[model samples]
Target: MSTPDPGDIEPPRDPRAAFAELSKIMLGEQPLSATLERVAQLAKQTIPGAADVSVTLLQDGEVASAAFTGPLAAQLDRQYEAGFGPCMDAATSGTTITIDDTAHSRRYPDFARAAARKGVRHTMSIGLPVQRQTIGALNLYGTDDVPFDEATQELATAFASYAAVAVANAGVYASTATLAANLQRALESRAVIDQAKGILMARHPGMSADAAFDLLSKQSQLSNRKLRDIAAELVDEVQRGGQD
Candidate 1:
């Protein structure tokens, strides 16, 4: 299949429509990475003079590009391997960092040189703030030396807000799904353990449920296995014997 170009996608000009598009992507069943990729593509399409766009995420105290429009955008983001690039700075400090002319930028000499060598003359990074905390950055690159105008910068900032909301909502949804799955597994394990306990009680007429559980626990410890696994094994063996 051919790769889809960001330029081919219709840009959402209105802020409300842009946010609705982002929300639709986030609310879908796709993974967070895919959603972030779509966000990057949307930003590239919406921002005028933007040659490329990337989403930089600070996960577990490490900064990395979570999504990008193309290889150039991803390469430029990684040029700051020392964790001192505009993208990293924006994400860490929760501020917008712009390099109007990469060749003349003194704030990040190394990154500027690298970006210039990669044909990127101007760049902007807007921090993605979620719930009073900065989680990432939205980075834009331009081949032209001209900096983004004030109005364009404002649009980028607004789009960053939408991206931040998408990230926050996606995180909450993922956490909720994980918790529900864990609870379901816990319930299933309890039911199986209870069945094993009943089997032990049936074998020993005077054994209480507590005693039966203790017996299973002892076997689990001696066998160097999980309590659940031990109970499952015993239950399976009894069922197979009954079938025979």
Candidate 2:
């Protein structure tokens, strides 16, 4: 006699499909920042009561939100600015912190009040532990007063574990790539500098290698350029002169 509204019908929960999608994300070639953003969105989709989701990362003693699904999730920024909240506590302590009712939360009263003002009534932060260290947190916010049940909490924890591994691997890959790039540039700079020094020494018969290097450094300082750049320019000029 009555038709159910499509908006009122809950979407089917397919944990397997969600995990499959996460696995594909891990295998994708996206950068760490994009990967984390997708992870936050995925968490919001996979978790039943998640009104919003955010990923908080702690680096060099600074806490910041790396990714978030909605404005409510971005509220974690206020916690980061204040230096204390469920997200920060979870990340620092490697523990899951839950606020069933933000209006009545005693642990982080200030953040609770702030979140309540934004219509957030429930929140949870799961520590993202990597290599035995807590590097960040996966945070969830809900507008409803009802707390996440034990089953939902367990599912969230499992999803967080998977996301943590992906994040750690991406971090390692990024660091290694940066190191390799730096090493390559260093080697190239050394080669060009050596060539420049040889050219200068050939021009000034008694010029020592150290003296030639000092000349390059002087030019670099005067021009406000890097020593490597100056050396490369000198080498290029010598080659061009020879060709002419």
Candidate 3:
């Protein structure tokens, strides 16, 4: 579903302003960690009562990276190791979970204690995916016990959705780059195989190149050896014959 239906809440009057900010982040040259740092910094700086923001990355069933600004950011690793925080559950569930008042909730005693000790009043988490698979979460903390109005929560989520796309796009681009490199390597290997067949054809004159290649293929299959290895041996034999 689109983050916020228009009927739910109209965006800021200068809707363009919010989008301009998002575009600037994607197009910027700074590293992604720097970009996430800026995202949190700007959110806390702009939003009323927002005390902190953090961007977390999960890969191979573990947290891979994280970036945050302010005191709350520093405490994230502790919560992760303790295994009792809203962000971890949200990342695993792939949903947004909110705790407006930690004191009353019976769930996650350890996290509640940590939040109380940290003076956290309210918190929210937005799950992000590297693709279809859940991989990370974005968390926001407020110092006052102010549950987000449905509208505010949605706007924040809309922005988080953008963050997820930015992260996933980087991953897809990297995977495609690796595939390109591998395909190039395979093409070069095939060229060598063709070169080996030519050498065999010349050594066994009157034999067609296709027929010579078949001989190598049959020998490789019968001996249960790799075709490349057999080709190498044939080339070596021709070289040794020349020396003799």
Question: Highest TM-score, which number?
Answer: 2
Q: What's the residue-level lDDT of 54 in candidate 2?
A: 90
RMSDs, each prediction? 18.3, 17.9, 22.2
**Lowest summed lDDT window (length 10), candidate 3:** 1-10
RMSD of 3: 22.2
Taking all chains together, the TM-score of candidate 3 against the true structure is 0.58
lDDT of 1 by residue, 1-244 (tens): 1122335535446666777887665454666666777888888778877888998776556676667776566446655446478898899888999999999998999888877766777889999998789988999988764688899899999889888988766656666565345335544665787899999999999998756776776676577666678889988999999999
Give the per-residue lDDT of model 3 (tens digit) for 1-244.
0111123222233434544565555433554455556555555554444566777666555552256664344443346655547788777877887878766656766676656555676678778754577757778776665666687677777766666766554444445454344334434444555677898787788987546655665676578665656777777787798899
Regions more than 4 Å wrong, model 1:
1-16, 25-28, 175-244
What's the true lDDT of residue 222 in model 3?
72
Q: Count of backbone clashes for each model?
A: 0, 0, 0
What value does the lDDT take at residue 235 in candidate 2? 89
RMSD of 2: 17.9
Local accuracy by lDDT, each model: 0.76, 0.74, 0.60
Error of 3 at 40 (Å): 2.1
Clashing pairs in 1: none
Q: Each prediction's TM-score against the native?
A: 0.64, 0.66, 0.58
Q: What is the model-wide C-alpha lDDT for candidate 1?
A: 0.76
Best by lDDT: 1
